[model samples]
Target: MNSFAKVITTLIGSFTLLIWVGKLDPAPYPLTYPSNFGNRISIPQNNPTTQAGVYLGRNLFYEPLLSANNKISCGSCHEQKRAFTDGKVFSSGVDGTLTSRNSMALVNLLWARRFFWDGRATGLEAQAAFPLSDPHEMGQALTVSAAKLRQSPKYPILFQKAFGDTAITVNRITMAISQFERTLISADSPYDRYLKNTYKPSPIELEGMRLFNTMPQPRKKIRGADCAHCHGGAKTYLELFHNNGLDEISTDKGIAAITGMDSDHGRFKIPTLRNIALTAPYMHDGRFNSLQQVLDHYSEHLKQKHLSPFLKGSSNKIGGTSLQLSAHEKKAVIAFLNMLTDTTFIHNPEFSNPNHP
Candidate 1:
């Protein structure tokens, strides 16, 4: 070919490339952290969140098309308004099928090492696939869902934007959804504000905080709620499993179901208390409808045999550790728990459902 012709062909190819780039609507969605969050966020190496990826994830999460019946989406159970929980004892699936356990809150999932009440799934990407095929949840196969997504005009573009290609797969779908979930970091509560010196806790709340952090020392008579032992405090909550004296004999078996170990019986993942006020109907089985009931479980009804060793009674052999909080103390604890509710998180427009289909 002549030099002039080659130069002309190159110019035409450059123009075509520019036009193609302009036609595509892929946008970068970088994850942002609040200054108050400190140095806590540790994104997984494989699924570092991108703006386009998160956008795709949010859409996929809300898309009911993933279900067999095209009637249930991840958002159906994990509603943002209720801090991503369906506010039911067990979340209903397609055709009114109910999940075995309560839908867990999706708040601050980035710090989570294990997913689900039983911790069946290890990574968030793996976790996203569970409900897609669960008989009681979305009730659809990921392969079938991936095929459907591939045929969708909207989803292909989303896939291309997020993953640098138009090819759709179950892994990509799970990764995208997981990326969106990773961005669901909740850290702007009143407790967070107090830490930053932007807000001051109420007197009762301060008292509640004191009790929550205080470890019970019977010798010194420092009777405390000791909630921070499990739930942690203003920062990100701990990700530990415990048999918090919920059952004398295990029916659900919780972690034991996964491990097939008698010692793990009745042990369940301890969820974050960041949005404790909003995520009611507490515990793995959703036995308690209110925070008061949860506190009561700790204070009065704590079981002895299978209780976590962290509890006061587990070591003393006096039975399970009971906070034995007074009515006023319980009220104070509830009040402090209310402060954990991050209004900003629940109402964030970015986290809400998209307007268009």
Candidate 2:
């Protein structure tokens, strides 16, 4: 080969090296949340959110190729319009099999340590795998999903941009998905506006807010909804599990299935009320179709033999006798819950399907 041939080969090698290096450094994502949202988010050091990673994750979230039949995606069951919940009692999986529980809303997940009603998954990265491979869900093996992503004309470049290489592994897939999920913050509701002093609640709604935060003191004639014990503060939920008296003997073991402790029986993770008005049917089983039924259950139907201590009344009983909120009071409580619906979140184009206009 001549000197000119050697120079041309060197130029080609340099161009290839530049292309590889160009994708090595993804820009940091501009992550922001409500200032009043309490403690700083605990982002995993290994998978810090990046603009490219979030973009890849967002596309992956809506990509039907992730499922077994190439017809379903994470976005199918967790539609943005219903605050990321599918609005079905139980979401239909890839094979049209029904899920065991209602799909959860994926809002402000950065603050949550546990995933699922049973709290089986310890982190967001681990949580993504369950639905993808669950027999009744997406029903696709992780290896097969990775293979499909790798074969895609677009995913290799996306993986290069997001993970610094074109290696389409399950870990990278989940990490990218978790990055997109962390951006789903819902702090622009009417209730949030009321806290910010930008919006005024009506007389009934204000009364509802007061009642919701107030502790029930039946002996003292103080009527309270006692909601804040499980769902309080700026984030609207305590990151803990509780037996909210859904049944006297719950057929589903809930957190107890994972812990194998009798005390944890029927204990389910406390979900956020940020967009409660839209995420129905409610509860782990999707038993209730409306917020009114949920309120009624707490007010007059709590029946778990071992209810959470927070639900006990002045007499310290494990029954609904503790909270017999009046008809008008129940109405007010529902009004307050409705205030939690953040229209801005559901309509936000940034969180919508990137493939759609």
Q: Rate the local accuracy (lDDT) of all candidates.
A: 0.83, 0.87
lDDT of 2: 0.87
Give the residue spans of candidate 1 off by over 4 A.
1-28, 34-42, 312-321
User: How many angstroms is residue 281 displaced in model 1 relative to the true structure, after the best TM-score fit?
Assistant: 0.6
Residue pairs with backbone atoms closer than 3 Å in model 2 (clashes): none
lDDT of 2 by residue, 1-357 (tens): 999999999999999987865575578887777778876685799999898899899999998888999999999999999999998889999888899888999999989889999999888999999999887898999889999988888888888888888899989989999999988989899988998999999998988998888887655667688688789887787898999888889998898988899889999999999899999989999999999999888887877486887675522123335577778988999999999999999998878899995
Instruction: Give lDDT tens digits, candidate 1, residues 203-320.
Output: 9999888877777665666767888888875554787888988888978899998898888899989898888889879998899999999988888888877887777362212333
TM-score of each: 0.89, 0.91
Q: Predicted candidate 2: what Cα RMSD to the true structure?
A: 4.7
Q: 206 in model 1: Cα distance from truth in Å?
A: 0.6
How high is the lDDT of residue 290 in model 1? 97
Q: What is the lDDT of residue 134 in candidate 2?
A: 88
